[model samples]
Target: MAKIAYILLCHKGPEAIIGQAEMLTAAGDYIAIHFDGRAKPEDFQQIKAALADNPNVTFARKRIKCGWGEWSLVQATLLAVEAAVQAFPRATHFYMLSGDCAAIKSARYAHDFLDAEDVDYIESFDYFDSDWIKTGMKEERLIYRHFFNERKHKWLFDTSFHLQQRFGLKRDIPHDIQVQIGSQWWCLRRRTVEWILDFTRKRRDVMRFFRTTWIPDETFFQTVVRHLVPDSEIRTRTLTFLMFTEYGMPQTFYNDHYDLLLGQDFLFARKISPEAIELKQRLGALYSNDKAEFKISNEGTSLFKFLTGRGRIGRRFASRFWETESTLGRQRELMIVICKKWHVAKRLLEQIRQVTNVPAIEYLFNEEHTDLPDLGGIQTSLGKRTRHRRALMRMLFDYYETDQMIVCMDPSALDLLQDFASDRSTTRMLEVQCVFSDEYLIGHAMRVGLAGEQTSAETLERLLPTIRGDMTFESDKIRDAEFEHHYIINEARDAEENAAPLSNFLDISHDKARQIAQSDHLFAD
Candidate 1:
């Protein structure tokens, strides 16, 4: 059995710690607890009692009080890691956690999973030039000065450039990863832990460098880890959805909503209110079909309860997300109908006139186009109106061929276009509505007096930079991947470009972008 140690850090984490402990217990790994030094004595007593029975549990004596954006948080973590390594020397892996975090998968499985990949397991860090102010970060000059003063570090400029490279990445990737700073909580191989702790211990300058920033905790460890293991698949982020309500932030504990606990992929998350917790649990269960458990711990709590509860919940939820067939049974129905009016256009335009035919020229124009007809069905016309339609048809037919044009017409016109294109060329012009495209938004805005005609075009020109800005946030390696994902010119490129012209959409304002970045609604799952 591979030994592992789980580290929990918190100011005053609630029952969720119990669930985490249970998770680790079921995984059969040892766990250690580190409470922020500022926690009340009574709270510490309660915590110690909760964890007392677990043989693997060891509560830290050295506690450091941490506040958001303070360096103390990172110090607390590093302290715990030092303790854990000494206490569980045989452990193969280390997963750091917060009191509010819950395990969505078996804690033991994480150690087992280490065998599948050779990643270093640091969360991704990307640049954020535009949202720098939004996230409450200091300007470049201040950040640079602070680090230089704190450690006299020479590499601040290089790190800044590295971050810039990530922000401007342009690629056509379909994955759900965004570059940002690393999270405090993470899972690292024991080898990595040993190396980082050693490096920081010998380099007091590096420690001082980390102490200068608002949340230097994220970057300090990330920077050091990246240096130590440059080529590892540092994920930099997980697929957890976070939400902060309009009122006070949510509470961290609850008992009835066990199903919510199982739906998460991460072992834990920031706190949620009791009301929000209920909703999150219920909604998660309804949509994802996962179950969750809640627990609490202090000094007395054992790691066993955390691991065991998590393992039980994870097994059930894993079967739902991974093993079971989907319960939502409906799928899209595509209807294909073959109609014959193949030769109608050719026959009407006859250079080889047949005597039995009707007045082909007049029939082309006299016919009422209640609905747009299929390309194969429309009679060839020489009148001005028919000529214009033909011009549009030629543009479309080049790509689709006569029989292939899938023009989406309301009920009546579908057959006409289909029939008309059947004979002339194999290419068919597909009919589609432009409602969702920027063109519709622009024109509708103008019609409703919300914008002038040029307003939409001007808005688009302005919005391009912001879109370009947001696209810049990427890790150094991921920036390269982004370039590859977005700019690839293929058959789909022409279709996508022609479909939505930015000239019709508003340039997203800075205010709007900040709102999007900060609003829980924007980030909500």
Candidate 2:
């Protein structure tokens, strides 16, 4: 088993943070927390008391008065990481998260997924990249000196920044090291983390340069990691899900985003507000049962009666029945159908749900329509149009939790699905099938079927196994597999036949395919 160390930077919402910590608590997992020095000491003590019983939980001895875009935030993270490393020398990986973040998958799933991967999952991009900024570059962040004490020196700093910009006099970026920027949250291997600490310690000049530079927290680690690791070894993607508004602020997740979050292939989600207590509770309950093995019981009273104290046994049994029914009698196999037309997806899902007791049945639909029955686990508005369907597919694969098999299909391909499901031998174990279109041109049909007019050959290749059948007999192997149980079906034949112009345009190597598979294709057309 892999040991993971989670370094949390928390400043508010003590209860929410505690809930996150509890959800992620597992054997060989260590939680090292750093309460911002600016936060109330009493609050810190209270949080400490709440987690005092967990031996794997630790607090940073040196706290920093962390502020947005300041060096203190970086310092606090360093302190927590150092504490965690010192406490758990055998920890295999280090995860940096904020208080607002919550685990979206089971601890077992996260461990298994990380253990199978050898690369570092850090989202880093060149500072000068076009996609790095939307409005324009803020030269002052990298070129001018701005005091961290924004409250006291607000006017002075503003004047200094404008004056430098006006005079066309900008500080030169360090020539020896290339600058990089990305999301602050990251998951790095133990060796990579140790290297970061050592590199920062040895290079005081790098530290000094970033201290006076604006928003050093975002660039410091990204720059150093990119400088040291090969591009092939770095997976320019973070395991946390964050949605930003048009104005460039982190969008707060709400109850409405619950399904969206669950569909994502991310371990953690961020910016959960304290007021969204219902969402918090739902996530807590959902992940609570996400262990290495599934345990079924007739024990425990009904939650409703446990709240009302009126009816107990009868309601408890009813609740249990509902759970079993919704989860396809707890059989473990999951079938997810993706379709652009809601009506098509609805009919297909209804037919499958009625015939099969596959543990889970979820629908990833492109459009939102009314009067759609509550077909158990069906998810709608996955994306606005067909182009966004792959985004939805990526989410479904990322946060999938069951130990059973997963089958995905197009509504048009339901006949094949029914045939596959009816054949017990085919559906009993894992399977992979690549379906080709005999009538329409495969590439044109693919563009019409999926959200993006373009699809990666690698993406198409990855989805093939879900349609055909690939079984992993051992439970351990299923858990450790990168895509152990998912079934992906798209309209393409063998890799050779898919060598047309459009296919050639999208055909990338396996390494590139894995990266594209994990990306958010919401913006793809």
Candidate 3:
């Protein structure tokens, strides 16, 4: 029989904490809990009373008020660790976990597995040499001192951090020790835990150095393990399986993830939502199935590994864009609607959407209308279109498989538009009704025999020459835009005639486009 002491740090969710305490004690293990000082007193009383019958459970001597990116979290964890060791003298190993973590397998399997291992299961990496820190302060986290809490006082934290950098306020770490960083979760042998606790008590210099360091909980224990423990006993991985988003935030799992969680190789998973009632209930029923001898695999992923390796892998996501990208799921759909004036373009978009009865998302690259409509299923970062237009389309197509999306752009962006129509695309060349020819708006004034006497004739007199010269001047530019088939809008022909050579293109009107959207003739291949 192997005894493992569990040190749990909890901030919220009292009922969940009591249930966890009961489960661990039932598994023949000892547990110590450190409740956050900021929690309500009534909540603490409820948790304490619920676990009163368990003799294997203990509480921290003192509670600490914890905040994000502060050293108070490390202090709370240390208190729980000490209480667990004192209460369970026969425990051979120590495991640190957050309140949200739950065992996917039996607790007996966890203790039996750890009891069989000689090496400690903790992730350790050289801080300076490793690319563990991705977004925020890397070397500066250790070089300069941070006083204000980053979450509570963001402005003050940034101001002080910058002022220290501007004046070269630097701190020197002891020359004998090397700084190491890793995940906050670990499962360590009792001998290793005792060594770490003893050193922190004796070395006041190391404690002071880590107190002001950013997120010291990640560094303090990891640094101690490397500086004090033998190299052969350290295994550079954690027992927890976790994942993070591209923005470095943890991905939360819900009841829908029950199958995914059970298929995982690790025994424990952190950051499960407290509101996931079905997940908690189903997983709780399986807690007593703790079989010995390799019931679960030791290989597991950590947050530190996920963050550093994010940008390197090929992404496979947001596949809902496929139906909108092409007429059918198989073809790539795109069209180049070249109308010089935006007023003509807007009316043309309305006609297509009304006739086809299909959702049409327009104004992607037009400068005047970058604020896209609230179109669902379109999950893209709009900022990328401004800085890297070509890269944005490539990334967009990677997530959204599309062959039939109607794309409207100014002639200037046509250079980057070619990539959207690849070898397997079924593209369309669309020409809309000319702005001046339309009878409703600007062209109306001139159409009703008021051009000669109108005071605005001066502006229109100068504009007619450019309108006459515009399409003919842009004939070569239009043909090279990589359009699959050119379709002339069968309204009254105007200067748009010069933009498209009549002999080489197909003729399509409102009726033709509507027909194409309903049936799949143009993309049969």
Best by lDDT: 3
In model 3, which residue pairs have backbone atoms overlapping below 3 Å? 325-402, 325-403, 325-404, 326-403, 326-404, 332-403, 333-403, 333-404
> What is candidate 2's CA lDDT for residue 418?
39
| Model 1, global lDDT | 0.44
Evaluation by lDDT, superior candidate among 2 and 3: 3
Full-model lDDT for every candidate: 0.44, 0.58, 0.65
lDDT of 1 by residue, 1-525 (tens): 456687788654445465456556544677878777755566777777887787777766588855445577778888888888888877777777665554444444444456666665666465343232333334342233232211112245346534644674222211322223555566777888999988887877656545755456666676677667655456665423233211112323344434444444444444433234554444333322223232432211133244334544774322311122211111111111111121222222231112111111212323454222233332233343343444333322221211122222222333333334332333222111111234544443565475664665678656545433332332122223222111111122333342232111112233432332232221111
Model 2 agreement with the true structure over 280-323: per-residue lDDT tens digits: 78777766555433332312223222532322244433333122
Per-model TM-score on C-alpha atoms:
0.42, 0.54, 0.59
Q: Per-residue lDDT of 89-203 in model 3, one digit per residue for the tens?
A: 9888788887778877777777666767687877789998998886557988888898986633455788999999999999898788899899988888888888888987999
Instruction: Name the runs in model 2 displaced over 4 angstroms.
Output: 150-152, 163-169, 291-525
Error of 2 at 473 (Å): 81
Better of 1 and 2 by lDDT: 2
- Choose the strongest candidate by TM-score: 3
Residue 248 of model 2 has an lDDT of 35
lDDT of 3: 0.65
